[model samples]
Target: MKDNAPVFDALDLDRHAFFFDFDGTLAEFTDDPADVALDARLGLDLMRLLRRTGGAVAILTGRHRAEILSHIDPAIPVAGLHGAEFPGEVLAHDPARRAQFSPLLPGLSALVAAFPGTLLEEKDAGFALHWRRAPQHEQAMIAAAERALTELGPDWVIQHGKFVAELRQSGGDKGSALRRFMAEPPFAGRLPVAFGDDLNDMPMLAAARELGGLAVAMGERDLPADHRLSGPRALAEWLERGLA
Candidate 1:
């Protein structure tokens, strides 16, 4: 196990730009993603601080932009579909090259349907079959998705999350999204910091730390984070004080 430094001090907040993962970083994980709720006061406070400091804040998630927006204010910048779509910005990478990947979706749907206990979730740019409820079939579901996606060739990418397998249009990931944001105006001069707590978030965590900024991991399972918080409440408390 890697030893993470202490939670960031409030004084360090002024110099950093915060990038967060919504699902497990800001809200507790639930069996159904739809049931996760945002801390309204926390969201409002963070937004206000970002505006006041002229620091940029964005969400980099596997979820579609619209889905993320539905749960929070749409005004917040979001990199969705793992950077396949960033509103107002020309896609840093093209999705057309990955069109052939769609044909595999039906097969994926069929596989999930036959699995009996898995939940097939379709997103704007990709599909995910979650097996959190069907732990017994988790390995089989992943193996099936891997085999199917592997057959699709190198252009398609498979992202594995907590009990979920995602097949998305390729050419970018959370790392690319973070880099793209760093090249833009508001986020350009600021130091990039990110928060997340899942396998999918590893790239963003690495990206932030690579740029000499903070990467915070939430929850009990330690991966890599410059700082660690117990869970969403601890994260919120840290942010509230940091932004204060």
Candidate 2:
């Protein structure tokens, strides 16, 4: 994340709804995603923003609700695994889906073993093959993911990102999550302002624009973003300043 000013000017952020992506947009990236943590200062600022927004702020993350709750307090609304609300149940838990996914797990695990530089991020609903530290192995990782997807059939899809390939449940995307939030309590009836940094967040960005709102890109990557923030530190500062 680099230092850049937000592009959307003169907009009253407090008056609109806010949705955030945690990994790259809010938290600093770590080699292991599990090692990522929210800065307490930002956490407090987030609490303030939540209050400022009339409880319309939400986190739409790939990580499960349990993981998010451990890091962020005040239990803000969240949608984990695409659009599934937290503490409810992830669609990946469906017995039939699990049965279909089980056959491909061994192959993916083998790929992880072969690519020591790559990491296998197992989730309750899906899995991700991360090669952030091993960018050179991108091609190899994609090939492995392809093989698994081919075997797993149409129920799975791969989300490509910076140094990573995520195999997830088909049709479960950020756009769906954002739409779900917009149709629900608090989030409903407000202009959605989303912030994110990767391919996974693109859908939500597009969705925000569609819903007559805005999308703030975390860094300078290609996406349907209306504004840009320098980095996670900048986001924290923006929120902290709002406390005044």
Candidate 3:
């Protein structure tokens, strides 16, 4: 990572498409994922950037599109479930594949029940074991997710974040999602600038840089990026500067 990065500005916005990760990037982490709220000021700035960029802004997140929509303008495009889902994209998995998760749930549920403060987040495409409030159970959570993946077979994979581990289908990832978005209207032909804060965000960050654009890492996690921001509050302030 470079110590000095160019100051973000409207000029950069004019030719670059903006991509952001939600938790820990746009909003701070909360013990309850459901309680993490987007800052109103940050939302407004994002909307303004979207408009200024001629609809070139999109959020690529591990969250479901609807969940992100609840916090921001529904008009802005969101690629959710770590790129497993997109606007107007229909996903149909084989019955056998769908049934695979069924076997994992009961065990995962039992584990969560056994550990106080740990959470199990069920998404449309996958599920995650979060130990944000129960740090001592982190290894247990990861082990459970790994076991779930093993049972699910080669079709499934694991995604690790700060205090969570997810087991989902193997095909889609943040980098692939970023490339897909950049191939479409209002996004194609524009530079890509991605902002993220966790391991899940790594692929998206690398994709942006590989595309001859910029990657802004949020907080510290040894992520490679063109620049870095302290955290979500600093990111919000950085966006404010671009608006000026």
Candidate 2 clash pair list: 4-230
Error of 3 at 4 (Å): 5.7
Ranking by TM-score, best first? Answer: 3, 2, 1
> What's every prediction's RMSD, in angstroms?
2.9, 2.3, 1.9
Candidate 1 regions off by >4 Å?
1-14, 90-99
Error of 1 at 58 (Å): 1.1
Give Cα distance to truth, residue 59, candidate 1, Å. Answer: 1.0
Q: Model 3: how far is 9 from its true place, Å?
A: 2.9
What does candidate 3's lDDT look like per residue over 1-244, in tens digits? 3333347753466678989999999999999999999999999999998898999989999988888999999878999989988878765555676577876787788899999999998876779999999999988888888888877889888999999998888887899999999999989998899999899999999999999999988887779888888788888887887687
lDDT score of residue 204 within candidate 2: 94
Error in Å for residue 196 of model 2:
0.4
201-240: candidate 2 lDDT, tens digit per residue: 9999999999999888886676767778866888888877
**Model 2 clash number:** 1
Which runs in model 2 stand beyond 4 Å of their true positions?
A: 1-9, 85-92
- TM-score, candidate number 2: 0.91
> Of 1 and 3, which scores higher on TM-score?
3
For residue 234, give model 2's deviation from the true position in Å.
1.2
Candidate 3 lDDT for residue 168? 84
Q: Choose the strongest candidate by TM-score.
A: 3
lDDT ranking from best candidate downward: 3, 2, 1
